[model samples]
Target: MAANSPEGATPRESRSWTLRLRRAIDQHLPMGHLLPDRQPYYVGSWVYVFGVITIAALAWVIVSGVVLSFMGPQWWHDSRLGRFVNSLHFWSVQLFFIFMVLHLWGQYFMAGWRHGRAATWMIGVVIFAVSILTAFTGYLTQQNFDAQFIAINAKDAMNSAGIGAFFNVLNFGQMYGLHVMLLPIGITFLVVAHIVMVRARGVVKPIDAEGARS
Candidate 1:
């Protein structure tokens, strides 16, 4: 401990996990940065809004999906209330994908990978890919003819590729578990990670700054 340190304070090298975590939080996400009322002027572009819209849609999707899971597929197809909720979840998915694609394209052309932000860019890409798989699993859990047909058709290909045993889409229970339990958790994790990384690095500079950096 330094001479000026408090009596019980641990040295930096051997700090407790709790202290380390608090330090990391302060270092990476100071209060103003974490919930800023202002951002760089370049972020004013219309394209920047799509990323937040995509996240909003995802939040709605998850809320509606949780309700749908409790009610189950039969209720969704038969009950008016359930159908309304199902529509919310479905449309939210569509909006999520639409905004996500637009955001991805906008970010890519802006060279979002610049300024030591490669991991942030890669994580965004992974989130997009994983979100598609999550949506596919959602479709498979719908318990409709479309789901049955898709599962049956895809299972053959999955097996030929030697992965069907592990990811047996034909099994309604497996697909349901994945959609309701596993994949949602994964998407939630990736979303959290992407948001944290964004806050840690700050947004990428505008494309014009790219050439100037060179």
Candidate 2:
């Protein structure tokens, strides 16, 4: 018998890198919890579906945006296939924002920040703000009269906030870079972080209507 073991005892398994990673996953996101076969009956409300629907819309937006990017702005404006993809991207944005707003309202009215979930709620708020900025940059990349009008008007607001010189809303190159790269990266980070936090904390429970009326 080894000095580290007592008589008739089984040897303990060493914590290898793969074992450590698996342990971390179990601790943070156990399989049953991450992919549950069932949920609390309170989760049956239609309101709960809005968040997932928003995510679906966001996915389609990204897919269509990718296609449009590969085709270029000129192709999107002039070609039939490009216009269809552009329309898909545009409609996806509208759906994403609409459902996102609904989700926000639902959470707000439910007092979703309660019970140590403030961090989750705060992350959701930040995601909303970042999404708005991402959409604004998308508008600036339109390369049309609408884009021009938005840029010229938005530049004044940016200047008043003391960032227009650098941000340069009227500069298509800068806006395009932000729309396709910087802002998307930021939004992606926020969304991933928010989802992880949500999974960790679980969904907020419904509050009492009687308590509210009182």
Candidate 3:
């Protein structure tokens, strides 16, 4: 007859969990959350690995970026090892974007954005936007003919968009540090945060009560 009771046994069972936690703490006993016995959480979707592959690609980008950073900007253009690392970094970026785009698309179709998972999806979209901006800035900092051309072409659009006032695209020095350091750090943190949220909430199952299997 409790006001909070919808189904008596179900509410009582839920409340019992809280009391057990309290007792465990009072008695200094180890307590853990009961994980669902759902098998739907890790359905054999290859798309599941797409997001992970993107993370792995980002890791490669970071490693190559670090090597290139120690060599400095000019060294990449002048030295064989530096140039090879730069190419590796460039390819890693391409791979990261490819995998992430696919992951996002797959999530959308799978309706992985359902439940309380909307926040996770929104945060991920923002991270994707940031990564794109980082990539553009990265391409601008190469200081090669391609970089010069892009800087010239992209300069006006940025100025028109008001971003040019805050950032000087022509400044390879600043862009270099931002690409290899600041933005990479930001992207890495975002990915880690996203993964934490995913693991904490667990994967959502589709409609038709299939989540019970999950």
Clashes of each: 0, 0, 2
TM-score, model 3 to reference: 0.79
TM-score computed on alpha carbons, candidate 1:
0.89
- The order by descending lDDT is 1, 2, 3
Task: List, residue by residue over 13-93, the lDDT tens digit for candidate 2.
Answer: 333545555555666668776766777677888888888899999999989988887777688988888888999999999
TM-score of each: 0.89, 0.85, 0.79
Give the residue spans of candidate 2 off by over 4 A: 1-22, 208-214
lDDT per residue for candidate 1 within 1-214, as digits (tens), equals: 1122233446863356666666666666788767778777768788888889999999999999999998776788998899999999999999999999999998888888888788888989999998888898888888889998999898898899999979999888888888888888998998888887787678887766644546
What local lDDT score does residue 210 receive in model 2, on the 0 to 100 scale? 38
**Candidate 3 pairs with clashing backbones:** 38-214, 40-214
lDDT of each: 0.84, 0.81, 0.78
Worst 10 residues of 1 by lDDT: 1-10
For candidate 1, the per-residue lDDT at 146 reads 90
Model 3 spans with C-alpha error above 4 angstroms: 1-42, 210-214
Model 1 / residue 159 / CA error / Å: 1.3
lDDT of 3: 0.78
Model 1 residue runs over 4 Å out of place are 1-14, 210-214
